[model samples]
Target: MGIISMIIIGLIAGAIARLLVPGKENFGWIGTILLGIVGGYVGGTLGSMVFAPHKFTVQPPVNHAFLGAIVGAVILLVIYKFVRARV
Candidate 1:
């Protein structure tokens, strides 16, 4: 996939993830996009470790990007909440 498409997907995934997780996220649109991009990377890394083993990049055939993004976003959100509470 292209960088543009990935970014778009990331934005959408982040928004969806934020919605799925009930809480007040202190981030704007840009932050959401960044969150999603990071989430995608995190998801891709974890998925690769679990499913592909040797591979690092997830291809279109697997199309685990969205799922991975959601999982990653949830994780990040949780961490963010925890840290924010502490601070």
Candidate 2:
């Protein structure tokens, strides 16, 4: 169940993340997929950490997996940008 959910969220989050970010991204399809999954975990962890006591029914909202993915993607994107700039 968790694995399936992660995949779904990864796809959605990766799409949303790409939209949120400005400019062009050079990652291919596979890279994007990986980014999304990682992003979801990142977003979920951060969300949970910061709002530990806020209990909002679903709390973590499984649907928000995409958000997590986006967070992960964004971080990766930033890192890529920074490294690219240095190179």
Candidate 3:
């Protein structure tokens, strides 16, 4: 909820996501944090749509959010790779 907590979660989620995906990511600490933060937003949004479409205030638990963050980060990384390759 706090800024510090968000940053920490982002770092962990980003690190785990990088490990799960099988490519070399050149981004460093700050990039990782940004990736995680964006991934968290994407994950939270998707989770909300999938799990509770009618409730606006409903939020997933922290653990579920964490997992979703990782999944989201992995997806972003894959997309980035594809886009970069095409550029």
Q: What is the lDDT of candidate 2?
A: 0.70
Ordered from best to worst lDDT, the candidate numbers read 3, 1, 2
Model 3 C-alpha lDDT versus the unseen true structure: 0.86
Report model 3's TM-score to 2 decimal places: 0.85
Which wins on TM-score, candidate 2 or candidate 3? 3
Candidate 2 global TM-score: 0.69
How much is 18 displaced in model 1, in angstroms? 0.3
Against the true structure, whose lDDT is highest? 3
lDDT of each: 0.84, 0.70, 0.86
* Candidate 1 off by > 4 Å: 53-62
For each candidate in turn, the TM-score is 0.81, 0.69, 0.85
Off by over 4 Å in 2: 2-4, 53-62
lDDT of 3 at 39: 89
- True-structure Cα RMSD, model 3: 3.4
Which one wins by lDDT: 1 or 3?
3
Q: Under the 3 Å rule for N, CA and C atoms, how many clashes does model 1 have?
A: 0
**Candidate 2, position 66, lDDT:** 57
Could you report the Cα RMSD, in angstroms, for every candidate shown?
Answer: 3.7, 2.9, 3.4
**Residue-level lDDT for 71 in candidate 2:** 78
